[model samples]
Target: MTVDWDWSYTGDILPDLLKGLRYTIIATLAGYAIAIVLGMVWTLLRRTPFAAVNQAVRWITEFIRSTPLLVQLFFLYNVLPSWGLSLSSLTTGIIGLGLHYSTYTAEVYRAGIADVPRGQWEAATALNLPRSRVWLDVILPQAVRRVIPTLGNYLIAMFKDSPLLLAINVAELLHEAFEVGSKSLMFLEPITLVGLLFVAVSVPSSILVRRLERRYATY
Candidate 1:
């Protein structure tokens, strides 16, 4: 069988794909925001004086990192509503993506925080700086800056992973592509376009991340 490519069909499906891409972008940004903040929380919790708290947080982070994201997504999608906390598919997807990646981000944060010189903490202690002030003003500023490029890489990964939300019916880019192709009985155009669109976003993002790595190399 011969395959024919139709530019007009591609144009016709562009808007729907763009709509799905919008959801994909939104989910990625929201999820990544949560990951960054929650990951820091996990890192800080692990550093707490209470050994129990540290161990518990460490175990939780390990468990999350060890599990598959899709499994977590399904669990949240199914379990939450039964507990009277039903979330929209998109919201659930965001939360799943965030929670899964938070474990990875926490490791990144731990590395960045560890790289902060011991003298920095000693100096803060000598000044009698409040713990909160030391973390917020001295530690986090450095740690976050160092991890920004790595986090940007995760953002791109999360964007690519957004299509997995279709498993829970979130209607992201790949879902839209599937629908268009299924209805039109033509998979090539929609699938190829979806791939190109992914490249369109991720390539520029990767370039920016490389620039950030260079600009912050001295930090």
Candidate 2:
């Protein structure tokens, strides 16, 4: 079937799409913030000297990373309410995106931490620095900087995946586009606008990530 392109229709729906874009950006930032902190915690938690706790954390991170994010979202949005853990749609989406992606971030942080020189740890210990001081004042500064590009890439990914919040009724960009299309009885303009909007953001962000990765690689 041939579908006509309507520039006028697109212009009319632009405002609605922009509103959704705002929410998309907000969700991405919030989710990425959660991922950043939780990811670091996960990486550090697994390094505990306690074997049982360390093993349990490793298993949990692996489980979270291996599972599909959509399934996690569904469980958080639908199943949890049944267990008396009801959460609003936006809350669920933020938590779901944060947690699901945090496993990957943890791995990135792990790689970053591994990149730190072993001698640095020895020096810190020899100086009688607390482990927390070693990590905060020395190790993490280098590790987190090295992983900036990777984390930025994930933020772009989470921005794209913000559409999945539709499953739980959080009206992000894709959901907004769908709603506009349904109301106007014209899917082409709204859907195409959504695509264009995603490209507009993702392409530049990807370029930035590449630049960051190259800059970090030099160091």
Best by lDDT: 1
> TM-score of each candidate?
0.93, 0.91
Q: How close is candidate 2 to the true structure, as a TM-score?
A: 0.91
List the RMSD of every prediction in angstroms.
Answer: 1.7, 2.0
For each of the candidates, give the backbone clash count.
0, 0
Clashes of 1: 0
How much lDDT does candidate 1 score?
0.93
**Candidate 2 least-lDDT 10 residues:** 210-219
State in Å the error of residue 102, model 1: 1.4
Candidate 1: deviation at residue 156, Å? 0.9
- Candidate 2, RMSD to the unseen true structure: 2.0
Superposition error at 166 for model 1 (Å): 0.6
**Cα lDDT, model 1, residue 189:** 98
